[model samples]
Target: MRYVIIGASAAGCQAAETLRRYAPGDSITLISDEFRPLYSRPLLTYLLSGEVSPDRIWLKEKDYFNRWGFTPLLGEAVVRVAPQSREVYLASKKAIPYDRLLIASGARPRLPGVPGEDLEGVYTLRNLADWQRLEAGLEGVRAVAVVGAGAVGLKAADALARRGLQVTLLARGAQPLSRVLDATAASMLMQAVGAMGIDLQRYSWPVAIRGEGGKIKSLALNHDRELPVQAALFSVGVTANVEFLEGTGLDDPGGIVVDGSLRSADPHIYAAGDCVQPHHLLTGEQWPYHIWPAAVDQGRVAGANLAGAGLRYRGLLPQNSLSLRGLKIISGGLGPHDAEDCQVMTELDERRGRYRRLVYREGRLVGLTLVGDTENAGIYMQIMAQQLPVQDLAADCRGPDFHPGLLWG
Candidate 1:
């Protein structure tokens, strides 16, 4: 059997590996638009901050494809997929036929189409190329205006501040990470950003980017304020790369909707990663969980099913682990602020800058947010994933003395 996978990121690569292990002798081909070898996308910010070396970002070795006996088509873009013909067409007029196809094409950064967005110093940090360009252009950038307060935006602001550049973080909502974190957690994170010398502005977004001589000069905000900066970086969000599957009847506004087996509307085609929206483990809602671990899990499941293993993916659990300067935070599932049915339990140590909030529904731990202390994040995630009842351990959970042994023993 011939298997073709579109994308070389976390999901695509993991799926290819799983297929190779299950099929052994089947022909496998991995295609990626990026010329560079497979690397961790989440580490781009660390790379910019000089926290991690360039070599450390690569996920695979030089002989990865050769060792696995797979065909590596690098720097090639899939322009279209013909489901009826079972062929994948590339931009270079190359057509590859496959018995099974996996579309893990991933996503691209969403850019705010404001005026002067094409200025020289305006940038987005999505892939390795974007990071390289931004890093090179930072030589004379003293101040940077980062638009958006999501994970990407906050991380970019942190990295820029670490590089000694004045950072102005603009958030469209009233607080950073407003969609995920509760009001208290958001306040704690805001304090951390302030300690790092980043100017955190809430309820602000760019109306237009003003430039002079083709370079960024100032950013005009909706609040009738202007920020003078040499560079502007946007980390708003991402849009799935599903344009290639337009005529395949598999594309959706959120993402490609897949069943339990990760199979698309067409049985011959499967999808994983940020390009597909699977069911949520907790809420049962179908949406794209753009997390690394979710992508890896989906990829493996999809590959197994592709190889006729008949595996069913349970669902995706949305989670985020972020580090701002010295503060570490881990959030998962639905926070207390997201649902009215959730019963919240909290513990706070303002002097120590530590906080924990657990959201329970029907006596089961449905969500959690841990800041400054995340050592037990893994245990909390496991409880939520298994839908384990935590009513008896509620008191223990609210304090730092909480231990896994309490539930087990």
Candidate 2:
């Protein structure tokens, strides 16, 4: 058996390791457009903070290739994926045949095509190369204006502030991570980040980044506000890396569409990671989630199905976690954006910059948002996943005596 994996990021790397463990005789080829080996992406911000060197970012050292039976082709990009015929064409015009192919092509950082975006000091961080560039470029650079208020963008701001650089963050929406954190929680977060010396620019979008002599210097805002900065980073979001499968029989976009068993719409091939969208465990609706844990789980399920093992893939549950400026934030499940009459509870200490909220629908806990302390975060996720309506009931848990043990069986 031969397995050809693309992207060499979280999902693709996990699939390769799983295949090597389950079927040692299988020949594996892992390709990555990145020059370095596979790595932990969550640490990119840590790298910017000067917490670790570039060498420390690798997920596995060079010995990993020889030990795991993987033929790694680093810094190589796949130009095309012909799943109907099971062949992958490289940028160098070489084609590799495969019995099974996994398209985990990961994702590229999304950059809004505003003016001066091509300027020297402007960037969008997604890969190690991007992180390295930003770090090296920050030399003698002082103020930075980051466009986008998600985890990555805020983390970048956090890194910059720690380095004593004046950082101004801009968000198109009124709230940071509006897709994940609700308005109330986002407001609280904004207050916390503001106290830490970050200029939070909400309800603002970049119209044009003004550059002097081909280098980023100032940016024109939607509100006609111009801000000066030495550098800028746009950490908006990402789209799937599916352009290579252009002629492939897969569905639209960079990710291939897969069913409950991780089978593509074509059935002959499978796709996972940031590329593919899985059925939501709660909504039962299909959409792409660009989280690392989900991508890894998706790859594992896909690999199992490809090994001819009958494994029923339970759709993914949405969960996300983040650590910003020493404050840990974790959230899970969905709230009543469409539905009402939710039982909501909050524990807030503004002086300490701590807030926690849990929303319950009917008699079951549905969603939660926590900051400063997330030790029992996973327990809430477990309850939501299990849909358990337990001892204290929804009303009782909402009170001050909310025992932590309610999370247990």
Candidate 3:
């Protein structure tokens, strides 16, 4: 049997490994647009800051595909996926036949629509090649503007700041990470990020990107405030890369829709990673969990089922973890804007810059946010995942020694 998987990122790599272990005799073909072996995507910011070399970013050995006994098709882009013919067409005009297929194409960075967006110094970070390109273009660059206030943009701003470059971060909203962290927690994070010498510009929405001689020169925010910038990065978010599945009969409103087993409507085709959205375990509503851990789990489940193991994926739970200038933040489950019936309990220690909050609905823990100290984040996530009754601990959940083992008893 021939098993084909597109992409070679976290999800694709995990699925290939699982298939190799489960069906040792099956022929596995791993196709990727990247020529390099699998590497850690989270460490790209560290690479940008010069804290880690390019060699340190690799998560696998040089000859990982050869050792795993799979055909490596690196630097090949999939142009079309014909579900009826059970074949994938590549840009090189080659067709690969497969009995089972996994579409883990992942996502690409989303850049806002503004004038001069296609300027020479405007770039987005999504892959290793993008990092190398951006790095190469940073020569003699003194000031830069990072558009967006999400994790990606903030990390980029921090890395630029660490390199002694003046960075101005623009956020459309009032605070950074407004989607995940509440107002108070966001304020705490803003304070720490500001201390890093980053110019935090809240409520600044880009109207146009002005350039001179086809190079970025300044960015106009709201038609008035113009900031000089030599380079700019658009890190607002990412969109699913499922354009190849346009006529493949897959339900892709914005992402590929998959069932519990990570299988698409077509039985032989499966999908995982950011390109697909799964049902939420708690609400049974379909939502996309674009985080790294969920993608790995989805890949494993997809591969196991493709190997005839008949596994069922639970669901995707939202989670995020970040650090800035010695301050750590971790959050899981629903956010404050998720539901109106939630009861939010919070605690803050200004001196230590620590803050924690718990969201409860009908005496059950639904969400949690921790800043500065996240040692007990695992326990909180476990409780939320299990849907255990946490009314007893809601009042004192922020304590250092809140025994989570009691839930098991």
- Candidates 1 and 2 compared: the better one by TM-score is 1
Writing each residue's lDDT as its tens digit, candidate 1 over 1-409 gives 9999999899999999999899999999999998765799999999988999998999988788899998999999999999999999999999999999999999888888889988999899999999999998999889999999989888989999999999999999889988789988999999889999999999998999999999999999996999999999998888899998887788675789999999999999999999999999987889776999999999999999899999999888889889987899999999556668877778898999888887877877778899998898999899888887665545676555676445532
Q: Supply candidate 1's per-residue lDDT for 131.
A: 96
User: Per-model C-alpha lDDT, please?
Assistant: 0.89, 0.79, 0.88
lDDT tens per residue, model 2, 272-368: 8888878877668787778888888887877776676656657777777777766777887774362256766777776766678787676677778
Order of quality (TM-score): 1, 3, 2
| Model 2: lowest-lDDT 10 consecutive positions | 390-399
Query: How big is the positional error of residue 324 in model 3, measured in Å on the Cα after superposition?
Result: 0.8
Q: TM-score for each prediction?
A: 0.97, 0.93, 0.96
> Candidate 3, TM-score vs. the true structure?
0.96
Whole-model alpha-carbon lDDT for candidate 3? 0.88
Order candidates by lDDT, high to low: 1, 3, 2
Clashes of each: 0, 1, 0
Using TM-score as the measure, the top candidate is 1
Output the worst ten-in-a-row residue range by lDDT, candidate 1.
Answer: 400-409
